[model samples]
Target: MNKIVYTLLIFLIFNHNFYATNYYVSNNGNDNNVGTIDSPFKTIQKAADIMSSGDICYIREGIYREEVIVSTNNLTFKNYQDEKVIISGADLITNWLPSDIGSNIFEASFTGAETQFSMLFVNNKRQKMARWPNNETDEMMMPEDVKTGYEDCQVFNTRSGKNGRRVKFPNLSGFPVDHFKGGIFRGIVGKKWINPMGIIESSNDTELTVTAISDDWGTNSSKMFTDNGKGFGFIFHLNALDQPGEWFEENGKIYFMPPVGKDPNDMVISAKNRKLAFVLNNRTNIKVDGINIHAASIAMKNTNNCEITNGSVQYLWPFFTRKGYAVSKTEQGGIFIDGNENLFKNMYIAHSWGHGIFIDGGRKNKIENCFIDNIGWIAQFTSSIQNFGDGTIVTKSTLGSSGRFHIRTNNKIDITYNDLYDCMKMGQDAGSIQSTNGGNWGVPLDLKGAEIAYNRIHDCNTLTDGNKEFVLALYLEGCFNYTVHHNLIYNFKTDVVPDGTFVYLGPRMATIKDCYYYNNTVWNVDWGLRVWNRENRGDVENILFWNNIIDGKANDGETSDNDRNVNSLLAKLSFKTNIRNITGNGNALFVDANQGDFRLQTNSVAIDGGTEVSGITDGFNGNAPDVGAIEYGSSFPDVGSNIDPEDISFELISDSSTLSTNSSDLKKESIVVYPNPSNSLIKITNLSNNYIEKISWKLTNLNGRELFTGKALTIDISSLPVGVYFLTVNKTKTFKVIKN
Candidate 1:
């Protein structure tokens, strides 16, 4: 522990990369053996403890049910040679016994010392907890799955500091109310957010009382679902555990009702006792690859320059943290990077009541090509990714689910070339990509920079109470100084908030000012733009709207100026009365608006009709700036993420025609099917555009027989006869090639 000795140890540790050691951990090995590939260590931690910089741990196949924390820097942890390695936070439950609860019911004593468990996994599948509106299928919290609606409840006898708020549910409810004294109240409680869950302190047939902590809100009978509506929630008790695949915990015992009609004795039942499978506790330059993590998460706390790719994290349930939504190991399901310059790419994340990838601090972190969906299905405060920091970027990713997109905290981010769909699938009062910022509340302030461009957001149709609910693709509240351009938004628009809209800018509690909105295309929606100043006590000023196209047959002609390009659904851009500081025109013409193409056409009125901004219109194709996202004559860049599992680096094919422009003056086409005389297979290659997996390709013989079809990054025609074949991209452009 002396100064010179410690400094010398640090020097040797940092320089150990020159003679890096290769350690191994296998389920079949022992810890006493040397850390070799043959005589591997029994646990991953055994290698992690002795490893310094540049040490590699090759984890062998099989599930290791333990939490491994790596505090060493410049380390590599990966599976050994395509072996299926799983780090699980769950322990196998073998001693299942019959329970007196009912027939086919079984109970197991709590063996782990964790005191409470949130998830019960049967053969790696998560089971539903005991509650009313029983999760009938894997469909999540769909409206039909739960018929319970908000009731005329009241919140009173409110106490601060964990006593929470006491709510009374009236209307003379039936059932033994005293037996549900300790049940939980899980409800939306009038707000789209805010899942006020608490224990039932006292109850009677006339009114059941429950307590919810936090002063987020308090409600009254007439105010249920209203602004001040406090009594808008439902309750569930342990006594309601009567469905298949349902389980509950009570008195330090775990109970289960077997799923798929399988007996507990015959199924691989496990309890999630450990919270995390891997913890990168303040380590740097580490890599975790090709490992499957079940019933746990990877918590990267305060680490930098780390990477997690080619992996997955599943079966993350609620790990409730007391006193605000605190960031901790308990609030993890997918990979979480809480540091700077970290990267999580090519990861598939699903099923959690938390964020898939949470950037808990302000730094330049990123998520690339990750397919994150089916998350936040349970309640509020969930998103596919939540960036609480500035300079965060999510690119080439497909994010969909019942939850929100990125949980914005007055933060700056770049959301480009991603596919977002099915947003607000089971929740409400939110947008697919939303930011509720600039309030008197103590959230972060002035996160005023977001580059939202080139993304495709659609199919945001979710139902509640058998009626279509309103969803927003881009909803920025109390936001300022943002640039939104070239993004394609469709289908996910609702005027219920005012008059129909695809993009919404609201001056809520804080001013919506100094934002540039231009070159965007909205189709199949009511209105292309909606600016609401319901909370206009704060100013709405300096909004620049330039070269936007709003089209589609849904709004054929609500007004005269609403041409096929400017559909008069709510007069193009619906602005609240007396709140119009917006400048620039929101009208334009498209090449083929009927087919959802927003590119400008020759002789269109939009050409040279707009102003020129510095960075945006620098590479204009026409005299000035044309209308809409893509320029009329310019080559189209690919939109959305390529989430294909088989994607990799392919040698770029040389084709001069693929780089051509689309204008009449250009001689060549912008996109082309390469290698006109392919030997076995051909690739539809575009030099200018990003790699797109959903770029459809179809192969057919001259006889009109379809040889190959479906979404393709590349098609294999090596098995076909040596003849000329027709290849189509998106069924719009067709090219001929020979399979020799």
Candidate 2:
């Protein structure tokens, strides 16, 4: 009885643990226990710490100021009730206090030397003042001495009819009121000194104001100043605008203004410590989902099998620096997967300081259904950044940079069904989706058994002027057994001055087969397909170009230039011969000047055409073969009745010997079968072939997998499926059958 009870208890516990344990996180909670409905953990990192496999951590709506890192495997972090869970930086509060009286010291300099000057104050105790020179010359002059000098300066008064009065200085240039009293002069603004006078309501001095009448003083009253001296005092000194000052309140809101000579600090945070927001070192089978990760110097580094899905990562721009200044210090990428076999899906990563999704060293990794844009903005490659402008999507580093994809070493990597646009200025290293260099150690060396398919690559050469070595689509080098099929490449050349051509297959052992190059329209392009072999490796053999449609002409006029269409295809071959069935309406192939050892037979249809003999296939319409992409063939019929209709039905008829035996008994003497291809099973009611042994039948596909087998001739084949199949009889010849 006790054993039975213990077994029941164990089963209950196992069933209970199989279901996901739901944990809730809210900002209002203070406890760390994720067990209760009311009390929950305050931080995502705290919740992630205790989460086990098959656990769901539901976070509530609120701004979280902490960084959450999930190294747990198969754990899901989702929003509980609200999706707008803002994970932001820690807010630092800054308090400000007003400056006390006589605490600030102001001075003036003219041409790197201290000067003493005066101004006219018409509203002072003495309207007319005399100018004075300082008895002592000091680097830091007193405000009272500067004010006394300004009070003694000459002034010209002009009465405005009967309402107001105006005053002006006699001399306009020399000693132009270089010192001021009880006032702060701001930074210079367009050849004029900007000063801040004391609160006008508190001062007992007559409220005499001065105004200028020219268009020079039009709408720039905040920065411009006039020398009309009257009750209005002209105070001049070094401006306090550039200096760092405290935040002040005017109505009820606070405003921060810097003092003179003080520039705004644009460096918000320096990530020189190589601090990463999230680091995955030698980890596996970890999943990070639905988190906003931003503002780290390096967002993520050295992760493997780490799936990051349904999230966004963006780097914040520097606050007050000029454009392109602090680009190097910004965050590196949304996710940097260096290890092998990682999967990233449905992630929106953009506006990073570096590559959006950088998979440096990985094998068999898959990145699909993700939106990656606006990357490669690092300051190290300024020209490349400028070529990308503001619309860079993604980049593989390849400017003699140490960070390379290293695809040559690792195989079985698939990059498909993702929108990659607007990333120009430089091509990738070897084995990338597209590369620039075509030498032996060049681009194609990395592509061993790689598959490039089903992508829309257009408008690639938008920035063509700077780097003339740009290969728009792909540069094939040293690659072997790779496939480039079913991709839409159009409108690649956007610049007038052509930099580099498109699709160059270098001196490499590779195969280009079964690729549908239909509607691959190009304008102003130098060459459609350029293949060369300067490396003399002798391994550049068996490169096939089957079933491809080459439509446009080469921009170069020469029939056999490297930039010419057919010449580009022939430059890579060693012993060229007549291609089989290369059909097209336009000029398809061009042989190079050095291609003399190559020969085309009299029956060879590609005598004048440029296609190689190995590229052509036997499945063409012409007597021999046509030149380029278009194949001339007989018009296909409606594809009706490959077999006669009499072959559709099957029946079993009794022989004359069976009927002659007995009409009622119908002694099974002989049986005859007709109509080989039938929709249903055949009937074997009258078995008259007495000498025949047991009947055995088998149905198979072309590769010979017996789908259905039976001993009885009247087999119930209602379950036998439809397709072209073969039926074999053990007693007689095998018959080809079709089930419809």
Candidate 3:
């Protein structure tokens, strides 16, 4: 049992034992001595109230603004050794007076346990929350406009005046018309992915008018605008709290403006009353190691093999209410995983407003080696890991969400090797790793042995949701089959998400759904792959691109004279009919991939040139597999956390260690289509005539969808499935069969 609880936690830390199961916790101690370690206990919920089930507490150092309810289980809190500990949730603010400052505006007062707030930290940073086109600097959360890349997604050309609940805005002329009277707009209306904030019921300069305060704002056609669709500010309002760290609140006072000019009595502020800093309620194998956990979060209810290791879960409590409608569940702010097999390891999670780790369910949960960043700054489609569950196992985590949204799931997931980046921020048709095919949410997709291998997904940029068949990097829509390999999906912080961005291979129904996309590597990314079929429902005939290294470079968007490949996304979205199942070719060169280092340099053209596939290139280093997600003189596998690990298991990589034996590239591909009877159908034969008219083929299974593609040297695999399958060539060989 974990080596008998680490040998009784090494005999209660080298013999300081008395069998009360070690407790302590301090700021110099005293919740009534006797909690040992020279009698500590000044509230870590008073040693989580008389510790029990495998007890271990230990805390120590300082800063602990309460809220810790652990219905005990196999416990073990930790910290003592590092002596850093912290668990605050704001709540300091002592005295400000100078008649409550001004212009440098400052003031305080609010003790009814402080009425309400979304944030305000001062010395700990994070201030600005006023708003009204107000942003002299200190860029407070969203509203950075600057893209004359010819704006006009039509939302009425930047809102040209509305009706019912009125809107207007499309002029500026000397600003100030009661600075957005009693503010709160936060736009992006007429549904360009619902941004919603509303409630300005009155203004002038350019025109305003809103009231229904919520419920998607009582129609002006549900807050109209759609031609360049979203953009608006207004917010908070105390006459837009004029710059300098801004903040606002009225009546019972509480205003500020010190993000730097100091002396609100030499700053230390803090406001944001405790909101459950660490609950682990209904606990089980509990283990909140290494402490830290600032602005508060962490509520693993129905908790199970619990374990929140390492440290830092910073700032959290972001936007719990801006008056509702459009996104809720009290708008996330990180860490909320609900139960079973939990174990958020090596944590670091930051900012938050919308998920940094939501996964609100139970089942093999395991977001390992965490480093989650910024996060959907305002419920921006709750990516940054939201809705993950059912055997979820996002490994080696390093997820970053600059423009928001990075993961939206439907279930049975296994995302490995992680390092994901800026997802479709400002949101739209996103996909920094998004999944669906739970019949698009009516939930039911469990496509058996799934596994999106060796991750490195990159920038799914956004200039207002970068519309171009919607930005990319592993987007899977009607998700079929599923064993996407050795990942590396590439770049783009701009070039405005050009045509089909990257990897879309969707599949809804049309019977035969598969996916085993091979030895991956995709750079620059602008249609490096895409095989659609959603309308007139599914059928792209086995999407293929084996031993991949798919390349893409120069592009400026708006379909710069079409033809970006993957048979031009099935002949320019004219659905199906592009017949280009691409095989490796000069391995699309990389090594510097403009500096994201996609490995494979000297004599590049993809070293060992692919075709391994046995539980994914199992331990190979040369003369064979080598495409993306690192392996050209091997290295890059620590995508985020794992310095001596082993203890995971969340199902994938089905059986016989992935079968498929024998090779010399499988004796030059059994001549072709060879799988020794068992189901049937394979072609090529005696391979000569320069390998039968310069070979080219694409089947599909191993769960990545597509059954028989072009340059067809014959294929049928009669209803397929038995184990192992692959066969590239002239893009550069790759053969590996087995089946029976």
Ranking by TM-score: 1, 2, 3
Model 2 residue 483 CA deviation in Å: 0.7
Q: lDDT of all predictions, in order shown?
A: 0.63, 0.36, 0.60
- Give the per-residue lDDT of model 1 (tens digit) for 43-75: 888998998789899876556788989978999
Whose lDDT is higher: candidate 2's or candidate 3's? 3
Q: For model 3, how does the per-residue alpha-carbon lDDT over 1-740 read when each residue is reduced to its tens digit?
A: 69999998888877643554878766656788877766667778888878876779887645677789887677788876554566777676656653344567777785523213556775355676666555555422344352211111122322323223555656433556655665665554444345555556667766666554434444434333444444543455677676677776567667777644455654456666776678886778888898877777888868888888887776675653454433344555567777788888887777766667777778888888887776766644667777647877889888775444566776677888887877655545556776766335322244455688888887666644333326677766666567787787777435554543656555434333455677776666656544444333454435445676655342222222242333323543321111123333323455466666766667765667666667777887877767555678776665755422222110110101111221122223223333233345555432222345556766555664656666766565656668777655544554565555
On lDDT, the leading prediction is 1
lDDT of candidate 1 at residue 639, scale 0 to 100: 59
Model 2 alpha-carbon drift over 4 Å, by segment: 1-20, 31-35, 88-284, 296-306, 316-334, 339-341, 379-412, 425-432, 435-446, 462-471, 494-496, 508-524, 531-539, 555-740
* Per-residue alpha-carbon lDDT of candidate 2 for residues 298-359, written as tens digits (9 for 90 to 100): 23344555666555444322111111211222322324555655665554444332444544
Candidate 2 versus the native: TM-score?
0.45
Candidate 2 lDDT (Cα, whole model)? 0.36
